[model samples]
Target: MILTTKSQFQSLIFTGTNGEYIAHYSHWSLRSVFQPIFGHNNILVGLEALVRIEDVHGESIRPDLFFSSTDISIKDKVNIDKLSRVIHIRNFAISEYKNLKLFLNILPSVSEYFALSDINTCLLSNRLKELQIDRSQIVMEIVELNANNEYLFVEAIKRLSQAGYCIAIDDFGACASTIERVKSIQPDIIKLDRGLLLEHFSGESNRLLEGIKMARALGAQIIVEGIETKEHLQAMETLDLDMFQGFYLATPQPILSCISNAV
Candidate 1:
């Protein structure tokens, strides 16, 4: 999916429903985004969120670029109510289907800026109450917790968990940062990198498998990313992955619209 831009860096715009605009990428709309997953009962389920953007063909855009950017201006443009938008989306998703858990990501560093104030301390908690969704149903995917700020990262993890959100360490086995992240945050879920999944059963595969086991032993769920082919899906089966995501199962789709009928 392509980004729509008013600024030269159109990528930085995040348009929410009701014409709410935020210059920051954090909490970008996902009303057009869908999370395809095998439900607890092993059935294919889709948990849709608000704030998703559509591409030229009306397909949902992948959010990786939006969330993981290094540009400081992009980060600053995000609203302090970013987490509140997430909580609102989670509630909306649950209203449609009670079976699937709501998967949402958090910029731990960004969230700390808004959540630390005494007045807005219960922002997330109040949203949870209004949504009537269980904290266990919320999976907060955390990205980019590397060696530089171990103390702050740890504090972020502790705070989120204390606020009752399940944590998942995303992009594991993709970077050199894996083991250190595990030692520091101890996430409740470990999302295997798609690159390692491509190296299935090769020398790298063994290392990935070991990492998965370690996370599992720590009471973390294992999710394999980037399953695009039958072979990839089969390889994931061998690992008994707790969850799956990739082009094969279902690519990201616009939340308010249906999956593309082009195929």
Candidate 2:
């Protein structure tokens, strides 16, 4: 097994997949891939953890569909979400990119799990300590939350931040992830959604630019995602954006291979 933690192995959260650690949930196999985030002048600043899923027969599964499907129970979602973060942190802790921030996504629907469990959150903190990784190098990015789960989401984010991890509000301006979320969560970073970027290119007013201004005023660093073209990046350069991510720069790749190359 790639995992060294005795408790991790005992819980069966991970198993070796061709020398790389991967999570298993229900009938699907889960793996971690990292997409690099760049700053001005294409400087690599951070990496985002994205989950890749495969069915038992080895067919590729779209992660977005898997995550958004209502068929999966909330309990299962919570387990998979926790497993994803664990695997990403494990892979990152042993890699050359350990110096860069690792952005891990949190599903809002499962926010109650974190909101209610100090023991579980403490285990995560302990894992970081065992790996000799700095808490500040981790960024917990929470996705959009609906009204019903908003309070718990805030509590979860606060718990993580209080434990020394940086907080980020993911997919701002999409779904329910609105400006109100930014105010309530008060995240360290605000990730502008790609949809807003596309809207900008269509001459649909600079709402994305306005968002950057608002986030900056709130003392939050801005990361413009979906810079799919030179023009898109150019638009961001005109603003005071802090980081960028999209296909134009690089695509997500298996964490094992990425860290190997970096080594």
Candidate 3:
């Protein structure tokens, strides 16, 4: 069943036959900040919801460290992912930029938890419908930490795609997966890893251009992440990237209206 209460922030507590699952927003000191994704002419096309956590003293907790420090069980990770989505949808529902697409990150392995009879899947689907968030507008960015289970990942992508959510391969170039993996999944979008732009590889520009072309030819859009300077932006201009996201364009913020000022 679905139950929620407001402490310091709204806490969504979902219980299934399995046991109690708590999305403790206040308990975890969790918040979601959105980074705007821009297309041609500096037009805002989407926003990626990034989770931020703070300590008791209101000190910021790095997301990576937060996850690493907590329980890494698949169930716990899935619960946190669900909580993030709920908050993002709730925030986006109240925002003026409802038309813009919302990109939500998901662990590639988390998909394995979403069986056909999964209660969490049902809850998530119901929540999305309740919020009136179109599935087409929500891009599920699959973060590839391990690529050994190609079959599992492919199956998960299929399920998500069939449910009408656009799939994206996040941190594409830096992932363990190869172009063969990209061809196998054929996601709706592929985000170039920030490392590719930060550390110059031999013929990095040419390599990126080729990569962009390859993704486009496969019917996927290319988004270059971490474009933090004019040089970065200028360097990508020649590649005809479908979208760009980085601190140079706009830092992740709590409000969508603030994005206009930043951009």
Which of the numbered candidates is closest to the native, going by highest lDDT? Answer: 2
* lDDT of the candidates, in the order given: 0.58, 0.79, 0.72
Order of models, best lDDT first: 2, 3, 1
Per-model TM-score on C-alpha atoms: 0.71, 0.90, 0.82
Q: Given candidate 3, what's the lDDT at residue 60?
A: 80
Instruction: List ranges where model 3 is wrong by over 4 Å.
Output: 1-27, 55-57, 68-71, 115-121, 147-149, 199-203
Clash counts per candidate, in order, are 14, 0, 0
Pitting candidate 2 against candidate 3, the one with the higher TM-score is: 2
Better of 1 and 2 by TM-score: 2
- Give a tens-digit lDDT track for model 2, residues 130-214: 9988889988888765634767778877877787889898889998778888888888999999998989888874778778888
Report the lDDT tens digits of candidate 1 across residue range 38-93: 63334664342334534445565445554444753433324422533553354344
TM-score of 1: 0.71
* Per-residue alpha-carbon lDDT of candidate 3 for residues 1-263, written as tens digits (9 for 90 to 100): 22222332243534323231223443455566789999999999999988876666878877656554445454555556667776777777777777889998876656654433443356666677877878899898877566336686777778778888898988877655457668877899999888777654345565566667789799899899989999889888777788999999999987544766786
Best by TM-score: 2
- Candidate 3 CA-lDDT value: 0.72
